[model samples]
Target: MFWKTILIVFSIFLSILLYRAYVVFTPDKTIFESCLSSTANHSLKFDQNRLRTFQKLLQFQTISYEVNKQNFDEIKKCRNFIKEHYHDLVTNYSEFVDLYDIAEYSLLYSIQGKNLNLKPFLFSAHMDVVPARDLNRWKYPPFDAHTDKDFIYARGTLDDKGNLFAMMEALKEYLHAYGQPSRTFYVALTHNEEAGHSGAMGIAHHLSQQPFGHNGQFEFVLDEGTTILEEVFPTLNNPIAIIGVAEKGYMSIKYRIAMASGHSSMPSAPTAIGILARAVDKLESTLQPSQFGRGPELSLLHGVTPYLKFPLRLVMSNIWLFGPVIEWVLSRKPGTDALQRTSTAVTLISGGEKENILPTSASATVNLFNDFSNELEKSLSTAARKEPLDTTNYLACQCIVTEFIKIIRYTWLSKKDSSLEQSVFFSLNGYSTLNKMIELTVTRDKPVLASER
Candidate 1:
C-alpha cells in the first residue's frame, strides 16, 4: 500500500516537472511580437539623403586585394574620394595631416580634435569592403545599397561600412553641435582591415610617436565587436550590450609525422599519414582540462541574474549554491562554454595526396586559447603535456618520425576603464529605449541562444 501510494505521488511529480519544462522551453509568440514592435519603434532614424551619400560611398568598389597591383585603381579612387569629402573636416582641426603613402592600393586618413592638453581619443574603422562571394547568392547586387522599409543592404553593410558611416555621421553631428570635445578625437580610416590591418598598423605606429596629449597617451579607444542582444537573458527586461572586455589569445601548433614512401601494394606496417592521423585523433579525443572558475562570463551571468526564474535566479545569485550546476552546463559544449574557459581545436590536416602511393609526410594544426592570467610558455607547456602524443602502435616497417611543434601566441590588451561597462549598458539601454517602456508587458520567454546567434 505504501509503495502504491509513493508511485502515484511520483507520477504526479513527473507530470508537474514536464509541464514546467514545457513552459520554460515553449516559444511565446506574443512576447516575440511585442519585442518586434519595440524594435520598430526604436530603430535608428537614418536619413534618406545621407543613406544615398553612403550608397555612393559603397558603390566605389574599394575592395582590398592582397596583391597591391591588382586593386591599384580602386584604392586610388577611394583615397581621392575620402580626401575630397574629408578636406573640410580635416582643415578645421590642426593636428591631422597626411601620415603615409599607400603602396599601390591603400588609403589611410587621420582626423584630430581641438584639445591640445588632453590625451587623444582614437576611433578606427576600415574603408575597404570584403569581396562579395558567390554573387548569384545575393538578393541584390552586392554593391547596390538597397533600402526598402528598414535595412541598408550591401557587401559592407554589417561587416564594417555601416559602422564607418555611423562613426562619420556621429562625428559630423558632434562637430556641428559641440565644436570639439575636451579631449582630442582622432579618426583613422584604414584601407585594409580585412587583409590583415597592415594599414592599421601604419596608422597606429604614426600615432604612437605623436604628442597626443599632456601625459603621453590616448584617453580612450572604441572598436566594433560583439553586438547587443535584447533578450539574451530571461530575467533581463532590457537588451544586454556585450562590450568585449578581453578577446581570447590565439596560438597555432603544427604536428608532423613521417614514414618511408612506398607503393600501396608493398606498404609498411603503418604509413606516415596513418601515424599522423592517429596522433590527431588521439589529441582531439583528449582535450585540455576546462577550468571555469571566474571571468567576464561569470560577470555576465551575474548581470543577468535579475531575469532568471525562481530556483535558477536564487542559485545564480549565489554561486556557491549552483557552482556545480553551472560547471555541468558549461562542460557540455566546450566551444559554446569557451566564453568561460580556455578551448582547443584541431583545425587543419594535411596528408598523402596520391591514393595509390604512400606519402612519407603528414601534418595537423592545433589551435587553442589559453587562460589570460597564465604565462604563454606555461600554457603552451601545459597544452603539450596534456594533449595525447602516443606513437606506440605503429606498423612494423614504418619508422615514426615526429617533428617539434611551433607555438605562436597573440594577445590583445585594453586600456579602457571598467566604467566602460556601465557606458556600454547605458548605450544599449538607450538604443533599445527599454527604460522608457519599462511598464510594457513582456509576455514571452526570453530569446534562446539559437535565436540570438
Candidate 2:
C-alpha cells in the first residue's frame, strides 16, 4: 500500500509539471496585441542648428545647491535664451499664448486652444539641475556639452533640460505645422525642482486661483520620467520607455535609544549602540505589506505577459499559482523589491565619539519610500467614476490608462541589475535619444494612441 501511494504521488507531480510546461510554451491572443504592431513612420526633424542650440543651453551652469543658493545670473540667461528662441509663442502669439513668471524665475505658459469644450492638460519640467559633486570624476567639464558621433554629455542633459528643451521644440513644431490644437494645455517650467518644488508650488497656487484649476479639472499631468531602457527583460528583445504615473511618497525617521554610559571594559548587558543596531536591523528585515497583485503592477504584468518569452510568460500569466515564488525572487533585489513593498534603508548612524567609551545614546536615520499605490488607485478610480466622461474624453482616458500601464510595466520589468554598459550608455546617450524619442512619440501618437485603448 505504501509503494502504491508513492507511485500515485509521483505520477500527480509529473502531471502537474507537464501541464505547467504546456501552459508556458503555448501562445494566445493578448489584449496588448494592438500595441505590439508597428504603426506609420512619423519622425521629428532635428537639424544641426537645433543640436547646437541644445548644446548652448547645456553650457549654462544653472545649478541649484540649496534653498536660496543658485546661479541666479546663469538662470536668468537660460530664461532669456528660452524667451528669445521661442519668440513665436512668447511674443508673436501673445494673443493666443499667455506667459506668466512664477516665483520670479519659474515660467508658465497657458495656451488657449480653439476648442473650449475639451478639458485641459499640463506638462511640467524643471529648469535647475543639481550641482555636480566630484567634478574630477567627470570625463569632460560638466557644462561643456561635449558631443561625439552618438552622444551629448553634460550635467543637466538627462535630469530636466533634455525633457524641457524637447517639449519646447515639439510645441514649436506643432504650432508651426498644424496651427492651434483643439485641446487646451499648459506648460510649467519650474526653476527650482532639484533643491525643492517651491517654484512648482507657487505655480500650483497661481493656477488654483483660476477657474479651470479647480480640483480634478485637468485631464492629466506629464512630468519627468525614467529612461528608455534596452534589454529590460532577459527574453524580450526590445527597448522600452517608462513614464512615471505617480511619485513615490517618502519619509526619514530617526530611531534613538538612551542607556547608561560606561567604559568598554564594563559595558552594560545591552549598549545603546547595540540596541539601536538591532532596531535598525529589525526594520530592514521586516518589510512593509506586499501590494503586488493589488496595485497597478499586476495590470502591468498582465499586459506584458504575452510579449514575454517561453516559461516567463507562463509563470507571469499563472501568477495565481506562483505568486509567492515570484515575490520571493523579486524581494531578493532592492530595486525590484521597491515595486512590491515599502523600502527601508538605514542611511546614517551616530553613537560614541571615543573608542573606549560606551555611548549613552544612539540614533539611526531610516529613509523609507512608501508603497501606497493600492490605496491611491482606489481613490483615483472613485474620483474618475464621479464624473461621467463623453466618448472623446473616455477614449482619451483609456489612452492615458493604457499608457500608464505601459509605463509601470516597463519600469517594473526593467528594474533589474544594471550593467556597466547600461551606466555608460545612460550617462552619454540617454538624454539626446530620449529627446528625439519623446518628440516623435508625442507627435505620432497625438490622436492615434487613443485607439490602442
Candidate 3:
C-alpha cells in the first residue's frame, strides 16, 4: 500500500512538470502581429512599388556636403520630387502639410492632422546622409540604387533614408485610403541631421514656440535607432523591433599637455605626445556607469524577460535580482553592453609637426555619452577628477561643450507606466512582435555607443 501511494504521488508530480513545460514552450501572440494583420485586413497595402520609391529616393547623393555649394540645389530637387509626387494627396489633406520654411539650403514640411483639438504627433527623419568614405570598397556606387534578393544597397539605405522614406510612403498610403488620421501627424525632413541637426533644431525650436510643447505633451516620437533581426535567440521565434525610447547625452572634451620644445636629440621625461597617449589610455581604461535607466534600456529588459529561460526568467522577472545581473553582463561586453552604459572614445589626436622637433603642445578629443541623471558638466568634472593624468604638466582644455537636448518623438508602441512589474510585461509584449518579425532573440543588451564607432 505504501509503495502504491508513492507511485501515485510521483505520477502526479510528473504530470504537473509536463504541463509546466508545455505552457513554457507554447508560442505567444503579440500585439504588433495583431496590428499588422488588422491593418492588412483593412486593405492597408504595403506596395513593393512604393518601396521602390524609397529606392529611387536613395539614388540621390544627399550627403550634407558641407563645403559643396551645389548640395543646396540637390536638396531642392529632392524636396521638389517629394512635393510633386505627393502634391495631390497634400492638396486633399492641406491641413496635414505644415510648411515651416523654404530656406536656401533646406526645406521643412510638417504633416499635421485635421483634428486640431487632439494632441500632436511627430515623426522626424533626416534627408541628409553621411558621405560615402570609399567608392572602391562598395559593390555598386554608393548613391546608385542596387538590389539583392533580400537587401537594398545604398549609403543611406540602412542608416536612415530607408526609415524616412518608408515612413513617408506608409503615411501616403494611409492617407490615400483613410484620409487624414485622427491625431495630428508631423513629419519633419531636415537637411542637416548629420551635421548637428542645425536644420532639425531650427524646426524643433520653431515647433517648441507653438502650441505643441516638448515632452509628453507631443504624445510620442519615433526614429531609427536599431533594426529588427531574425533567429537571434533560441526562445524567440520572431523578429524584434528595437525602438529607442531615449538617447544618450553627447559631449566632446579636449586634453592638452604642454612640454618644452627642443631638438629631437634632447628629450624630456614627459613629452607632449607621450603625456597625451597616457591620458587617452587612462580614459579608455575607465568606463562610465553601467546601471540601466529609463527609456529603451529599461523598456528592453522588461520586453525580453518573459521569454528568458528558467532561472534567468525568474531573476529577470524581479527587478532586485535582475538589475545587478544586467548591469554586470553589460559591463563585460564591448558591443551590446555599451547600450546601457556611458562610453568614451578618443577620436582625434594632435602633437608634433616635424620629425626633428620636440612638440610643445599635444591635444586629444574625447567624446562621451551620459545618462539623463548625469549631465555634461557632471560627466566632465568626474572624468577630470577620476581619470589618471599628468595634471602637473598637462593643461586640460575644453574644446567642445556638451548640452542636453530632448527630441520630441514617439514610437508606434505605447509608453510604460511607473509600476516596474507591469511595465516589464507590457514591454515584453511589444518586444515579442519585433522578435517575431526580425527572428532574433532580444536580450538585455546596452545600446550601441555611436561615439565608440
Candidate 4:
C-alpha cells in the first residue's frame, strides 16, 4: 500500500508537469504583418553590387582572440575595401559621415542629421570575425565565401558581418537616393566586438568628448537579433520575430582549489586533480533558484499565444492560474532555464602541467549570465552561497575529498591523516581582490539583466 501510494504520488507529479508544459503560454495576435505599416517598411534594394561587397567583406580575415588583435594586415585590408567601396559616402558626405577611426581598428561613423529637433539613433555592427579553427572541417575554405544560388557560405556570414554589411548596404542606398535623414544617426562598426569591447568603449569616449547631449538621447536602437522562427512556438504555423526587450547580466568568477602535490607515479588518492574534479562536479550540479513564471518567459509565451491550437490554446490562455506549474515545465529545458535563472558555466580550468606530476593547485573560471529579477546586486548576492543550497551535492564532493585525502596522506608524507584534520585544507580559498572588485561593480553600476515575465 505504501509503495502504491508513492507510485501514485509520482504519477500525479508527472501529470502536473505535463499539464503545466501544455498550458505554457497566453495567446496574442501575431505582430509580423502589422509591423510593415511603420517607417520600418522602407524599401531596401540590396543588388548584386551589395551582395558582392558582402562576399568580399567575408574574405578578409578580421579575427581576434580574447582582446588580442590578430591578422592585422587582413583587418586593414577589409577596412581599406570599405573606404574604397563607400568612396562617395566618405568624400561627398565626409562632414556628415564623420569618418573617425578610433583605436585604428574600429570605425565610428557619426552621421550628423539636418534636423537638430530629432533625437539620433545608433547602428551597432562588429567588423571582427571569429577564426575558423581546423580548415579541414569546413566544406569550402572558411574565408573563400563560396556561393552557388541559395546561400553564401563563410565564417562571418551569419553571426555579424552579414548584419554589418546589410546595415551599410541599406545606408549607402538610402543616403545616395534620399540625401540626409531628418534625425541624426551614428554607425558604430566595432573592430574588437568578437574579443575585446575596446572598439565600443572607444566610440563611447568619442561621444562623451562631444558637447553635452550631442545627438540627444536615442529614439530606439536596433541590433542583430532573432529574425524569424516558424517552429519556435509549439502550435504556431506563423513566423515569430523576437524583439529583445531586455539583456541578461554577465559576470565571471574565478576560483582556486589547492591540495598537496606529488609525483603521479606515486599515486596519491585525493590529488589536486581528483579534489578539483569533485568540487567542479558539485558546482555544476548545484543549480540556482528558478524564476520561470514570474519572469520574462510569460511575455514570450504571450507573444505566441494567439497561434496556439486547441487545448494548448486553453492551457496558455490560463497561464495566470498555472504559472508555477508552467515554470516547473520550462525549468526542465536548458534554454528555458537560462531565461529563468542565473546560468553557470565552468569556462576555464588549470590544474597540472606534466603527466607524471600531481599539481598542488587548481583554478577554474565560472561565468554567469545573471538574471535581473530584483536588480544586478540582489540577484548576484542571491546566487552567492553563504549556505549550500544543494547540501547533498556539496557534501558529496566534500565526502569524496575526505575519503580520498586519507589515501593521499600516506603518499604525500603529510602531518595530518584524519579527515577532520585535512578538511581545513579542502576548504575553499577566497580572493579579497576579486571580492572587492565584484562588490564595487555591483554597488556602483548595479549591472543586472534578466528576461521579463
lDDT of 1 by residue, 1-453 (tens): 999999999999656654543443343445335443334323345777678768877777777555342354675686677667656565665444333454333444444445577666666566776678898888888887777886767887776767777877777656555565666565666666655434654455455546642235456666555687875544556676777665555555666656556899998755666656666776667655555555667766765665567566655666654677887776676544776555667888787869899876777777767554444455455554543334234221111111221212211212442333333222211111111100101111222232342
> Candidate 4 lDDT, tens digit per residue, 197-264?
45655666565455424334456556655567677657778777778655565555555545555787
The TM-score between candidate 1 and the true structure equals 0.68
- Candidate maximizing lDDT: 2
Sort the candidates on lDDT, descending order.
2, 4, 3, 1
Candidate 1 global Cα RMSD: 14.2
Error of 3 at 123 (Å): 1.2
Measured on C-alpha atoms, candidate 2 has an lDDT of 0.64
**lDDT of prediction 4:** 0.62
TM-score of each: 0.68, 0.70, 0.74, 0.74
The Cα error of candidate 3 at residue 288, in Å, is 1.7
Q: Regarding lDDT, does 1 or 2 come out ahead?
A: 2
For the record, the alpha-carbon RMSD of candidate 3 to the native fold, in angstroms, is: 11.5
User: Which residue pairs of candidate 1 clash?
Assistant: 235-307, 269-395, 270-395
lDDT, each prediction: 0.56, 0.64, 0.59, 0.62
Residue 166 in candidate 4, Cα distance off native in Å: 0.4
lDDT of 2 by residue, 1-453 (tens): 999999999999756755655655454546336665233432356789889989988988999997679998999899888878887886766767888887788888888888877887778787788998898899889999999888898998988899899988878767766667788888888787766445765676666666665433667667777787777566876566665555454444454555556799997655667656665665666666677776656765665566677678667767888899888887787877788875567788888868999887777766655564644233223222322122231233343234333432232113332332222122222121111100001111122334665
